[model samples]
Target: MEKLYQVALTMVEGVGSIMFRQLINNFGSAENVFKAKTDKLLKTPGVGKQIAEGLKNKNLFAEAEKLLNEVEKQQVKLFFSTDKDYPSRLKSLYDAPSILYYKGKADINSVRTIGIVGTRQATDYGKQITEEIVAQLKPYNICVISGLAYGIDIAAHKAALDNNIPTIGVMASGLDIVYPAQHQKYAEQMLEHGGILSESPLGMKPIRNLFIARNRIIAGLSDIVIVIESAAKGGAMVTAEFANNYHHEVFAVPGSLTNKYSEGCNKLIKDNKANIFTSVNDIIESMNWDTEGKVPEKNTTRNTEIDLSQYTQEEGQVIAFLRTNGETQIDTLSWQTQIPVNRLASLLLNLEFQGIIKALAGKKFGLKL
Candidate 1:
């Protein structure tokens, strides 16, 4: 298929993505496009003046030849749509990439995959929730997918790696370029455990448009997407929107109402694009995912000392508030339970760390069911 590598050849200047695909459909392959006369190209849907003008000089394959050489030189692999290793879930999307460049060792054909996405400036709350949920997703042989930005993205990757779950980072830039260079170490580590994926050619820098395009692959590549944190507007919401468009499930961990990072998630649940998650179990159950064989329901099995004397006043207050209200806001715990704000903060953080209660959006707290 070396000479038949028409897809790579079609990706050159002038053809662009849309026109390249249209030409492929009309002519059957890049070789045919090269062999076809001008009128045959114009007969293709969405292939017109610009594309014909672009292909006027058949020598344009020079760029594609160089790109292919770079791919081999960099040890990168490419997957065209419908390739056996092409993610079937992603291939079903309307906007699935016509080509993808990959590096590293992820199988790409894992049993299942889920995307974890969120803000660059993730909160401590966001980090904790992401790690705990990823830890729970560990045993399902599911590959975790995400953008390789900071905060929740890195946390998810770390947790997945720590738990031996393969992960994939979908990039807005070329595989040859790494965006937000701080992730260099983690990206290298992903090569050992998972892989990095990109739709653009080598040397392409990340642009705003690229990130928007990148989200679709993240959504399409997975059966579901879990929003770890997002602003009232950001890439995570974009991923959720793409997941909704792709007819896939979207899950979000509710954060404090006062937190800027949680606003997008609250909007997603309110808009009915994403389900509300209080625990990893909430996410799995809401998606109708069978967690029975996937992973042990961690917090569902509780062990406790039947004594309140050993607990501090703040801990006592949080527990009482949960039991009384069934599910109550953290603020109400301070107000109704008469615990001071400073102390309530410390206690709830501690209790959350203990997994005694699940924190929901808007600073709401609920008893472990």
Candidate 2:
């Protein structure tokens, strides 16, 4: 009955996600919000005359009941913001949805989650990079999250499916609607491995405003956000902004400055809004993912490549520091060498990949000698 009132409260004309949160928090419950008179509702912070008036609509409960029945018939799962299964990351956001509907076996709160987003008009380069990143992240069992839009978002989901990794598509429409329509098959297949999620209730259209709202969930569900490719203005950039605001790690793949599609990513890097993405190893190293116990054991033998002539200037600087200091912590090396921590992580990963430096326990680095 409380859940029904919660659903009905969402139907109030002037109420939105943030407003819903405020109302519930102030009144102590959704039912309480409904029970309170207009004067009482007005006393809540941010609730004005019009919004408080909307709160008095008694007809919304019938609509809520109908939607709840539809959800039940369709076997869709409903999670209120306060539910135990509600995404913890998303709950931290000030404007997170009051209700979420999903269908799938994937856990929204996976141990490691990443969001890959780019422009809808993804270039071939964007598609390829998206696939490559998802493929590489598979071993870590990262949950790939994205908006179920066209281009890069679809590419990320498809790549995760191809790599047998869990991928979630946060929809701009209702759970019953697939926005692009053509990718319904992809949505269906994802349920076998991941899930399609949304805050919109049944019969809701995929409107422009809804997608802008949808982007927040894409950012919220992620521990990190990677902009694979994006133009100067797009939803991908919006998602990146949300991620940065939420204090999640944001990365952008550097591409040629001449390419128009790369402008958003390049700008993000240049503005110091995102770390430069060098490789999947950079993410793993930055996240400090545990490979020792979680992933399958690999061959312990080191295939050392002793050649140092090909190292970049940054790589050389890191190598030189490790050699001089014997064994140094990553933070210490970053401080001594004057490399940003993000860039240092990438450099160390490159050196480790070439067997030039070995990563020790506790993120320390040493020259292989």
Candidate 3:
């Protein structure tokens, strides 16, 4: 298994997905391809004289194993596309990666997975909307996937963790490499729940073209993609394009007309490239997904007729506040209800401890019911 993995890594090095597919088909396995002579390698589908010569000179199989060993010492798991645990969504793509490296516990073959992508430079509105979507997807057993860049990517990951949903970070760089540098800690947290995934081998830079290829894997690995915010030309748009091309459902949140970050998403909805989604239910229905087992159980449901005498006035007031507003800021609630911030915090905390309200990002509280 390890040798096949190492062999696939060699053929895919510096090669695009299509070429990698051709090589895999002609060679039967990465092991055989790596051991093949130049002329034999050239007979493989996509292998030109130059590519064959390149393969012959370098001992990439050994190099890949060495680099992967370094990653294993960091406790990362090297995953392959042929592995039984590989995502079925990805397996169906026309040009799936020859291999993928991962960390953490997300079962790639799980029934639910959603890709959340958007602009690298996000505004406050974008961040807020991304947080809401992540929280909504949490109850639906959705595994959030992103490029793990800045802005919306980090926002999506953080919100997923905050809401207790596992998320996957798909990088254009190698598994051992953490691109964007700023997201290393956030990536670590993802490892704690879902995991980090990448098609590129170690020591590879996350250049422009590489990212475009990575985008396809992201789209192909997901059943649906929700674009939060994006510029007219952005990596998020690229992922959406791949999603559409792959016959996966694509949804975008409409943003302000004048906002630069929203143009790409707005255009998608306007052009019918994607459906407009405001809440998790919209996406679930559009994708024709049954999220019955995905959502967290609701316990805060009150018996409208008989629950009046069961709780104190303060607790009742809190419930009413949550039901009416959906999610309220902790400080805002204290101000509106004339309760001290600390006391209000405690009350809300207790409510959550009792499975009444689901906590959203940035101190916002919403009822689970």
Candidate 4:
């Protein structure tokens, strides 16, 4: 019943991630949000009368119920934002999807993840480099991520399959439909070790804006993003931009400047937006990753119970919020704690310096795991 309301809330005409957060915060749950009076809904921040009225539509629930049935029939998994299994790296971003539809066997929250993106019109050199990069990364036990398109995207996925590396494809279409249908074979093969994921609803077709939106997930899911080849204005460059904004480490292979596909990579390097990707060593050094083929142990030293009396009231408030909400953007912390952004920024820096909390991509902060 809760899952049904969760899906129904997403079907509301104007309810997006931010609004969904606001509703959940105010109502304490999606089911409550749906049952709230129109007057109450109108008072919630950013929930205009129009959106509030849209929540009253009974058809949304019927639609959501149908989708849920389809998902169950197809063996698709739904990851809500509050789910423990949701991707931790993406959960802190302001615009991450409220729900994700996933299929296949790979762990989306793997210990280490890398996103590989490039132009669909990849050259042989680009394809070879992508393959080599995946192969080299095998020993580190990386989960490869890409859009699962043609050219370098497919090459990376295929390489991961060959290397027995878990690879996830963030798709523009629904999980039931694979765009560029020729890659359906590879998509099926991925189910053995990797998987395909999407935020779009079942039966949704690939569209231009959706592809652009899908790039953010690729950027958000990765600890690092590597652009293999791209023209000045293409999907790969867009993904790189999203990565930079998210504060994820970005790397671009230096390609021949004369090649049109290399223009984006060179420009990214020139602008100091991405590091030059020469070898696997670049990623190892940048991320300080271990190459010994061992998974790092979780930090069990941090006690779950904290003595709030040891900290100032404001600091205690921030800690309490983070304790309840895993990773959160600084702006959200400010809004929730009623602290000015400037003051919160300094306070967060102090906490980070004290090793009480760590900064993450997109200006988010979380207690050290």
Best by lDDT: 4
Off by over 4 Å in 1: 1-10, 13-18, 291-369
Candidate 4's C-alpha runs over 4 A off are 302-369
Model 1 residue 5 lDDT score: 54
Q: Candidate 1 on 1-369: residue-level lDDT in tens?
A: 533356445555665555555666667877777767778777877767776666666565676778888889999998876465676565544456778889989888665678999999998888888888888866556899999988888889888888888999999999868888888888899999999999888999999999999998898777778998999899999999987766567888888899999999999988887888887777555444465545323342233442456678668766755665555544435556667666777887887787777775424566664
Residue-level error in angstroms, candidate 1, position 195: 0.3
Task: Give a tens-digit lDDT track for model 3, residues 1-369.
Answer: 545444444555465655665665677766666678887776666667777766664566566567757766877665555556666566555577766777788777655778889888899988998898888666567788888888988898888889878888888887667888888888888887888888776667788888888888788877788898999988899899988776667889998999998899999999999988878788767644466644333334453443535656777787777665555555546545767666877888887897776776424577775
70 Cα displacement, candidate 4 (Å) = 0.8
Q: Using lDDT as the measure, what is the rank order of every candidate, best first?
A: 4, 2, 1, 3
Q: Each model's TM-score?
A: 0.76, 0.79, 0.73, 0.87
Task: Please give, for residues 202-300, the per-residue lDDT of candidate 4 as tens digits.
Answer: 899999999999999999898889999999999999999999877788999999979999999999999999999999899887766676967545443
- For TM-score, candidate 3 versus 4, the one ahead is 4
Q: In model 3, which runs have C-alpha deviations exceeding 4 angstroms?
A: 1-5, 8-15, 294-369
Cα lDDT listed for each candidate: 0.76, 0.84, 0.74, 0.88
On a 0 to 1 TM-score scale, where does candidate 1 land against the true structure? 0.76
For every candidate in turn, the CA RMSD to the true structure comes to: 17.0, 11.6, 16.8, 4.0
